[model samples]
Target: MNEIIRLEHVSMAFRMDLNRTTSLKEWMVTLLKGQHRHKDFFALNDVSFSVQRGDVVGLIGHNGSGKSTVLKIISGIYKPTQGKVTVDGHIAPMLELGSGFDYELSGDKNIFLNGAILGFNEKFLQEKHDEIVAFSELDDFINMPLKTYSSGMLMRLAFSIATIIEPEILIVDEILSVGDAHFQKKSRERMRQLMEGGTTVLFVSHDITEIRKMCSSVLWLDHGKIQMYGDAVAVCDAYQAAMI
Candidate 1:
C-alpha cells in the first residue's frame, strides 16, 4: 500500500494564560516578577501514526483529548511542537464548517474562493461547478450572499464543495453534524464513493456508530494519549467497555 501520511512522535502544546494577559506588556510584567503566568497544555502527547492510501481511519476521544488537534496538524493548519509530519498527497480537510468561506461574498462566489483555498485551481473548480451546485441543492440561492444563508444551507454548500473534487487524503472533523439527515446521508454516500475510489480518509467523530460504519481502523484517544489503535470493531468495543 502507498503511504499517504506519516507522523513520528508528533506533539502540540498551547500556552494558557491564567491571568487573562493578552498583551506583551502584561506578559512581560508577569514574567519579570519571577512568576510564570502561562501554563503548558499538551494537546497531543507523543502521538505517532501512519495511514495508507485507500484507508479509512477513525479517531475517537473524549473531549479535550487532542482528537481535533491531530486532525489540524494533519491538515497543515497547525504545526507540531515536536517530531515530524509527512504528507505525500493532496489533502482536503473539513475541520470546521465554512472555515474557508467568505460570509460576505455570494454563495456562488465563495464556492470558487473556498475551492481555491482547498487547493483546486479555477480550471478544476469550473469543471465541477455544476456538479457541486446540484449536489448542494442550492441552485435558487447560489447567487445570494452567503450571510443570508441558513446554517444548513451553509453547511451543505461547504460540504459539497469540499468533497465534490476528490483529494488524495481527506480529513473530516465532526462538521457533518450541521446538515439535515437527508444531506448527511448524501454526504456519507459521497464519502464512501471517495473511499472506494482510493482516497485516504481520516475521520474524527464522537459518534461511534458513524465511525464503525465508515472506518476500517480506529484509534481511541484518552487524556491526550492513545488508548488503543487497531481494528475498528475491536477498538470500539474496548472503548465502550472502558466507558461502561
Candidate 2:
C-alpha cells in the first residue's frame, strides 16, 4: 500500500506563561521586576509514524498523552515545534464537533459554511446538500438556528457535512461517542462503509473495544511518546496488559 501520511521525528511544544497577571500594566510591572517567566511544555517528543493508504489506525492514550496533538499536527492545526510531517491527498478531519460552525446561523447555512471549511466549493456543496441533510436525519431542523440544537444535533450536522464528500483521509477524534446509541451505530456503519470504499482512517479514542473493532493497527502513546506501534490486536493487548 502507498503511504498516505508520515511524521518524522515530530515534536510539539507549547509556551506556558508563569505570570498570572491579566492586564498589560501588571504584566509589564512583573516583567520589569524580573518576575515574568515562561516555560515550554513538550507534547510530543521525537514521535514518528506512517499510515498507508486504506489503513484503519487507532491512536489510544490517556488524557494529555498527546493523541489529539498528533491529529492536530496531521490536520495542520498546529505546526510541530520541531520535526517534519507529510500528508498526501484531501483530508476530512472531524477533530472536534461543531468546529467551523456558527451557532447563530441556521443549520442549512452551517452546511455550506462547514462544507467550505472542508474545502468544497459552493456549487458542490449545493449539489450534495440534500444528501447531507438526508444522511443527518435532521430534515425538520435544517432551517433552525444551530444555537437551538442539542449537542447530538450539532454533531449530526457536522458529521453529515464532513462525510458528504468522502475524503481520501478521514481523521476522527472521539466524535463517534457523541450521539445516541442508534445514531452512533449508524455513524459507525457509515465510517465502515467509507473505509471499505478505500478511505484511510486514523482515529483517537479511549474505547478499546471500538479501537479493536475498527482498526487494523494501533499506536499507543504515553507521556508524549510511542509506547507501542503495531497490529491492532497485539498492540492493544500489550497496552491492556500494561494498564493492568
Candidate 3:
C-alpha cells in the first residue's frame, strides 16, 4: 500500500492571552518583570499517524480534542510546532464551508478563487465548472454575490467546488451537518465515489454512525491524545464504551 500522509510526532501550541485589557501601569509592571502576558495551550500533543492510499479514516473526539487541528495540519492550514507532516500527494481540505469565499464577489468569481486555493489551475476548474454548478443546483443564483446566498446554498456551492476535482487526499471536518437531508445524501454519495476511486480521506466528525458507515479504520482522540486506533468497529465500540 502506498502512503499518502505521514505525521511524525506532530505538536502544536498557541499562546493565549488571559487578560483582554491591561492598564498602562500593569503593562509597565509586567515589562519590568520581563514577562509576556500569555499562557501556552497545547492543541495537539505528539500525535503521529500515517494514512495509506484508498484509506478512509475517521477521527472521532469530543470538542477541543484536537480532531480539527489534525485535519488543519494535514491540509497545510496549520504548521506543527514539533515534528514533521509529509503529504505525498495532492490534498483537498473541506474543513470550513466557504472558507476561501469572498462574500462580496459573485458566486462565479468565488468559484475560480476557491478552486485555485484548493490547488486547481484555471484551465482545470474551467473543465469542471459546469459539473460543479449543476451539482450545487445554484444555476439561477450563480451570478449573484455569495453574500446573498442562504447558508445551505453556500454549503452546497462550497462542497461542490471543493470535491469536483479529485485529489489524492481529502480532509473533511463535520461539514456534512451543514446541508439539508437531500444534499447531505448527495455529499455522502460523492464521498463514497471518491473513496472507491482510490482517494484517501481523513474524516473528522462527532457522528459515530457516519464514521462507522464510511470509514475502514478509526482513530479516537481524547484531550490531544490517541485513545484508540484500529478497525472501525473496534475503535468505535471502545470509544462508546469509554463514554458510558
| lDDT leader | 2
lDDT of 3 at 224: 86
lDDT of each: 0.88, 0.90, 0.88
Task: Give the candidates in order of lDDT, highest first.
Answer: 2, 3, 1
lDDT measured at residue 91 in model 3 versus the true structure, 0 to 100: 83
Residue-wise lDDT of candidate 2 within 1-244, one digit each (tens)? Answer: 6899999999999888876778999988998999888898999999999999999999998899999999999999999999999999999988876679999999999998888887899999989989999988898899999999998899888888887778999999887765788888888888889988889998998999989998989999998999999999999999999989
lDDT of 3 by residue, 1-244 (tens): 8788889999999778665336888777777876657888899898988888889999998999998888988888898989999999888878886889999999999999999887799998999999989999898799999989999999999999999977888888877755899998898888889988888999988889989999999988888888888899999999999889
Report the backbone clash tally of model 2.
0
What CA RMSD would candidate 2 show? 1.6
Whole-model lDDT, model 1: 0.88
Q: What would the per-residue lDDT of candidate 1 be over residues 1-244, giving only the tens digit for each residue?
A: 7788999999898988678677899878888986756788999899988887888999998999988888899888899999899999888878875788888899899989999888889998999999999999998899999989999999999999999877888888876665889988898788889988888989888899988998999989887788899899999999999889
After best superposition, candidate 2 residue 88: deviation in angstroms? 1.2
Candidate 3 local Cα displacement, residue 236, angstroms? 0.7
After superposition, the stretches of candidate 3 with alpha carbons farther than 4 Å from their true spots are 18-29
RMSD of each: 1.6, 1.6, 2.2
TM-scores for every candidate against the unseen true structure: 0.93, 0.94, 0.91
Count of clashing pairs, candidate 3: 0
Q: Is candidate 1 or candidate 2 better by lDDT?
A: 2
